[model samples]
Target: MGEKLKLYGFNNLTKALSFNIYDVCYAKTAREQKDYIDYIDEQYNAERLTGILTTLTDMIGATVLNIARQDYEPQGASVTLLIAEDSMLPRSQTQLAHLDKSHVTVHTYPEYHPETCIATFRVDIDVATCGEITPLSTLDYLIGSFDSDIITMDYRVRGFTRDVNGKKLFLDHPVTSIQDYINPEILRRYDAVDINVYAASLFHTRMMIKEPDLQNYLFKTDIYELPPLTRLEIMNNLRREMIEIFNGRNIY
Candidate 1:
């Protein structure tokens, strides 16, 4: 292990990671759009989401103190996990009755356009940890957990921890960008951009899949069956959707 920092007391630094991902599809018709939403809903139900969060807890070496999950009406699922640093609390003492500031939450949204026949599934996850646990370690796992046609992530370290000499350190680790934590293979597949405020200890990264295959965006339709012109139209629409979501704006 690297030389441990001699701290005045418990580490008071709070590191938070917020990840948002989008999966886009062309349903072609209202019925297909409904089917797409239903399919996504069933694919990521409360139970599955709970499993994902539990795995994340384990991956980050955290203890799950409590869990609350729900499946919403229409089409959505939510899961919340209250977690504690791995060795901070005894196993027997960590129970649902206990509460902590650290948490992992995921909320899924499956939506469709009113007139464009475009459908999208978006998952938003927020991981906030205090003390020694850092959420940046799970960046790859979070990206791989979803379809992730377009991804937007924000990470920031807040609060201050005192060193043995009574010096305050706002950030415990160095973070140039969230992309640095992502795997090179994954990074190679996406075009990524970073907007960071180093002085504020905040970093943001946005990514969109580069050279996405047109067939992957079609729901219940085969690209081979479509004429060249029709295929072009669908590809254009899908690319437009991805661009809009990645850039957070609409395009004509």
Candidate 2:
């Protein structure tokens, strides 16, 4: 292991990771759409989201100071966790000041196109940390926690800290791209693009599944039950939806 760099006082550099994960399906009828929404709501309720975030906190070597979570009225949920970097710190020392600096949040959105019969579920997550704990270490776990068809991620390092010699350091670590932190096995499953500004310390990556099976996108419906032409149509619609989401624009 490389020798750790000693810093003067506390390391104040902030690293944040933001994710937008989309899952698409063909619901066919309004009833099926409603059922799909209900299914997603139950599968990713606030309580479940809290558990996920709590695990993430632990994975990053952070201590949870407080958690606020709620399930919405019709079909959605949100969870927020206040965290601190030093698990060994006394409760009195790990107060709102530290809690406010580090946090994890997740929110879910489920919706359906009434005309197109396409149902989509979206989950948004943000993990921000201060000091030595980098959120990049948890990318694999975060991606695995969701049914992600298309994913967009943004990572930025903000603020600065001082070294032992009193020189200011903008970034404590080296990061050329977010993909470098992701698993190669996961990278093989998707087509990914990166937009990074090295000078500004901002990196962005977008990923879409390379090949989607028809059976996987079908909800509550058997592939053998549908005619060949219907199956082809559903496949096209699903691909179109994924393309639109991956590109962030509608195709005409």
TM-score of each: 0.92, 0.93
Clashing pairs in 2: none
* lDDT for each candidate structure: 0.86, 0.88
Q: Weakest 10 consecutive residues, lDDT, candidate 1?
A: 90-99
lDDT of 1 by residue, 1-252 (tens): 245555554466888999999999999888899999999999999999999999998988889999999999899999999998743443344311212369999999999995777899999999998876788888888888889999999998888876657798887676788888999999999999999999999999999999989888889999899999999988888888899888998876
Task: Give the 10-residue window scoring lowest on summed lDDT in candidate 2.
Answer: 91-100
| Candidate 1 stretches greater than 4 Å from native | 1-4, 86-100
lDDT of 2 by residue, 18-111 (tens): 9889999999988899999999999999999999999999998889999999999899999999998762333343321222359999999999
User: Residue 77: error of model 2 in Å?
Assistant: 0.1
The C-alpha RMSD in Å for every predicted model, in order, reads: 4.1, 3.6
Candidate 2 global lDDT: 0.88
As a whole number from 0 to 100, the lDDT of residue 243 in candidate 2 is 94
